[model samples]
Target: MITVDFSRLTVSPGDRILDIGCGSGRHTCAAYRLKGVRVTGADLNPEDLKEARGRLTFHDQLGEHGGGAWNLSAADVTRLPFPDACFDLVVCSEVLEHIPDHDTAMGEIVRVLKPGKPLVVSVPRYLPERICWALSDEYFNANQGHVRIYRKSDLIARLERAGTRFLEHHYAHGIHAPYWWLKCFVGPTRTDSPAVNLYHRLLTWDIMKKPRITRFLDRLLNPVLGKSLVLYLIKRRL
Candidate 1:
């Protein structure tokens, strides 16, 4: 499920893109399909890195992948291996909350992103995430799980402090918020229950069918109840 709007980010075909904390390489694979971009998927986990590479290889075999270059790397977000001002675009989705030193990670994003380029950062929205935390302790207690929740303003302020110019923001996955809330309510492990199973089926149908009703409902609800908050930032030359 692609959240960041490529058009809004104005990605050029040959642009260099980085997907930091690229677990399972969902977004990185998407970028590779953009055709002609050099895409890098970086994560601290060796397993995730391996999986990302495997996905890229699979895409290449199927001929569904792009013509551009793509690679997977193991790297820390707070201390990235890239040179300063290297990438044309950087995507850090659902990642900041997992880092204890998110400010340092943000600084690295700003440092490696070329001046005037875009950085897309997303996290769980405060209210929905707060509700999840209240409902289940398992939600945030896992290894490498969320350590903090960020209000929109606080997130923006921190990015600005790290030297990124605030551009704009949006919300996504409104339909998924209730699914998670239900999971939290019943216990994250209890997906076999009837109510949760029904909801899961509905979500699967919505994702597969893209029915008009759910799409309309999600658009209406996203502003108020989106599960994720997506922020756009630009690096300023310092």
Candidate 2:
């Protein structure tokens, strides 16, 4: 689901990009594959950074998985190590809600991105996230997991206040809302449960094969039931 929409974050060769909360390096890998853009994937957790580095261009076909041309850094989003205006693209997918200091993070994101370039911010949609929180204490109670939820408008308002002049916005991953609800209802960590296991298998199949039946269904249902809201913003040129 992410890969499809993420392709729109296009870049030319040598374009510098930053994956500020690059968990698992999915977006970072894709950027390398599509263009020879220099990318830095940064995260606060050393463990996630290590795992993300290992998967980057490791053992995949030569032409597959973004060609492994990326640098991984252990760093915090609120305080980036790089200088100002260092990247043409910045992506903070599924990471903002976890930070209690979202404003600081937003400031850093804008600071690093070259003015007029695009920033893609993705968060769990309000309704789907609320459902998960309502269903289970473990969802947000983990403390290490999501700390807050975001509405598209709320997020946009923050970016605007931070001086990021966004030009457009949209929602994505509508197919995932139910899968998470199922997990929350069954048990977020209890993938072993019969119902949970079945649902996981179905989701895996759906992503891999992308059957036409489900494709059309998701297109129809996404506006109402999408799991993630993707906000595409641009930093006004100085």
Candidate 3:
């Protein structure tokens, strides 16, 4: 399930794209399928990188890559390995809230992105995330879990301060918010709850089937109940 809206951003053949904290290569593989783009999926976890590489290889086997080149790297967001002004586009989704030094990571993203290029950043929405935190400590207290919750205004200000100009914003995963709330209520790590299990199956079905009713409801409710907030920005020219 891709969070960043490709239609809102411009990507062309030969462009280089970076997916920071690219857990399991969801966005990385999405970008790779754009045909002729060079996509890199970078994360701090070696295991996640390995998984991403496997997924990318699977895409290659299935001929789903659209002729794009791809690579996976184990890298920290706060101190990336790429050269300055090297990437045409950067995607940092569901990642910043996990980092204690998110400001430095933001700066690194701007440093690597070419001036005037687009950057997409996403985080859990404040209301939904706050609800989860209120519902259960385990939701946020788990290892590598979210350490902060971002109000839309604060997040936009942060990225703007990091040398990116905000363009637009949107919300996503509206239907999934309730599923998480249920999990938080039941117990974040518990798998035995029948309600939670049922909801999980529903979500999995929606993701795989893309039924019309669920899609309509998801779009309808996204404005107010969306779990994820996605922002679009462009790096400032020096």
2 or 3, which is superior by TM-score? 3
Error of 1 at 99 (Å): 0.4
lDDT of 1 by residue, 53-166 (tens): 898899889887668989888999999999999899999999999999999999998889998888999999999999999999998864258999999999999999988889
Residue pairs in clash, model 2: 33-66, 174-226
lDDT tens digits by residue: candidate 2, 1-238: 3522655655777888898888777777766665567788899888888887877747254556444367899889999999999899898888889999999999999999898888888888899899999998998855258999887788999987876876665666666778778888877877578877776787787777999877877778778987777788888876
> What local lDDT score does residue 190 receive in model 3, on the 0 to 100 scale?
94
Candidate 1: regions farther than 4 A off: 142-144
* Top lDDT model: 3
TM-score of each: 0.94, 0.91, 0.98
Model 3 residue pairs with clashes: none
lDDT of each: 0.89, 0.79, 0.93
In terms of TM-score, the best-performing candidate is 3
Per-residue lDDT over 160-226 for candidate 3, one digit per residue giving the tens place of the 0 to 100 score: 9999999999999999999999999998999899999999999999988999999998999899999
Order of candidates by TM-score, top first?
Answer: 3, 1, 2
Clash pairs detected, candidate 1: none
Q: Give the range where candidate 3 is weakest over 10 consecutive residues by summed lDDT.
A: 137-146
The better-scoring model by lDDT among 1 and 2 is 1
Please identify which of the two predictions, 1 or 3, would achieve the higher lDDT against the true structure: 3
